[model samples]
Target: MTGVEHEPANERYAYSRTALARLALSDELRELADRAAAGVPTTNDMWAQPGEVVGDALDLVHQAQEALVRAVIYERQKHTSWEAIGEQLNMKRQSAHEKYRDAVAEWQLALQEPHYPAPSGAPVRGLRLHEAAYAPTTAGARLDAWVHEHIPAQRETEHPVTGHLPALSTAEEMVQVLDALNHLYGDSRTPPDPKARARVIERKAALLDRIAVEQGRPEAAQQAEEARALAAQLHAEAAQAPD
Candidate 1:
């Protein structure tokens, strides 16, 4: 991976689930608003395709409902109690828990087994279901870019809608991203193939070295040295893995 691929926090190379859920909620709400604002066709024309129009509206409503569920999941992620969520949804706390507890359980289970084996002989070690389904890297970048393009004014304000977006492309975040990637992909100590693993470690080292330089933090520099040492060890291990 090119360390340069991620730069400037606003360009966002990674996203937390909360951000993705918020974006999904906002999108569904916008669609509902647009549909509501679009006035119905005049009498004779309205009768022409009533079923189609009503069906489309029904679909939008369903999507918006699901989006609300996802928004609840985001709140749960932040440790908001069922009581709080139920109050927001205008329901009883027990009702809210019953409605969303399964989804929340599934989310927790996915995190536990973050990656599943790909079909035989796939290039990467495995596919990450949560990453693919909920928070793909591409989704993060595109969502950030969409906001910047469509709602330029958001950049200037601390509006609740746009505020609190993570700066995952920043130097500090890069280190965390690498750490997460390392854990998700395989154990760094005994990866099946070291050639690719070594390269990633090297990139992490380079990023740390850069952060150490730009931020005037010697600790990061020391970490970079440690990372490089690991990379060197991995490179040596590569010879043992058969082609």
Candidate 2:
């Protein structure tokens, strides 16, 4: 797993396809199948296992997602209306367009013709992997944060607020910020990025300030303000000093 880079693992999404598949549903998986056939309750321990139902359900969700991607491809190729897509997806036209706008654009730009040498079923995933790895644009990150927050709404689990990424950031800065994030979360053994120091300080100070205000922690708020001022000073100094 050391060499593998993938999505952030959350309750809603699995880390990787391989990892998910490797997770055996349960020894009772076959028994659960039998119980279902007999129209009996499957949750009983005799025919069930803890977490297995949810795990199997999530796997089906992953499968559904693959199919959904292909469907989007076909629909976009056919020049389907966003309203129709939205209705099918149980969302508004704007919501449907917003959700898949980037994807639609990417596919449209990539393919010169509809056929394009007989596209494979899962070609979109490869493009996605490249986008994730070298996401020089904030669009990817914004969409990612949005998806993460929105998907878990039904579960009532709050996600972290990823404040807007600086639009003025260069590709190099984006890379640095991404490296820092990956180091902090994606892997335990990796060290943080030196280039992300200023942004890291600023972002942490901003988050702390938000938390303090929300929790009515006056002392914490004061500390966060002081930290933000310090970060600003460092940023100014670095800007002036030049690299």
RMSD of each: 7.0, 21.4
Estimate TM-scores for all models: 0.55, 0.28
lDDT (10s digit) by residue, model 2, range 10-95: 11111121111111121123224434444334555566678777776666566556446545544654467989999999999999
- Candidate 1 lDDT, tens digit per residue, 133-198? 334445445544555655667655444344555433554457545654555466556644566667
What is each predicted model's overall lDDT from 0 to 1? 0.61, 0.46
Error of 1 at 28 (Å): 3.4
| Residue 236, model 2, lDDT | 72
Clash pairs of candidate 1? none
TM-score, model 2 to reference: 0.28
Best by lDDT: 1
Best-fitting candidate, scored by TM-score: 1
| Count of residue pairs whose backbone atoms collide, per candidate | 0, 0
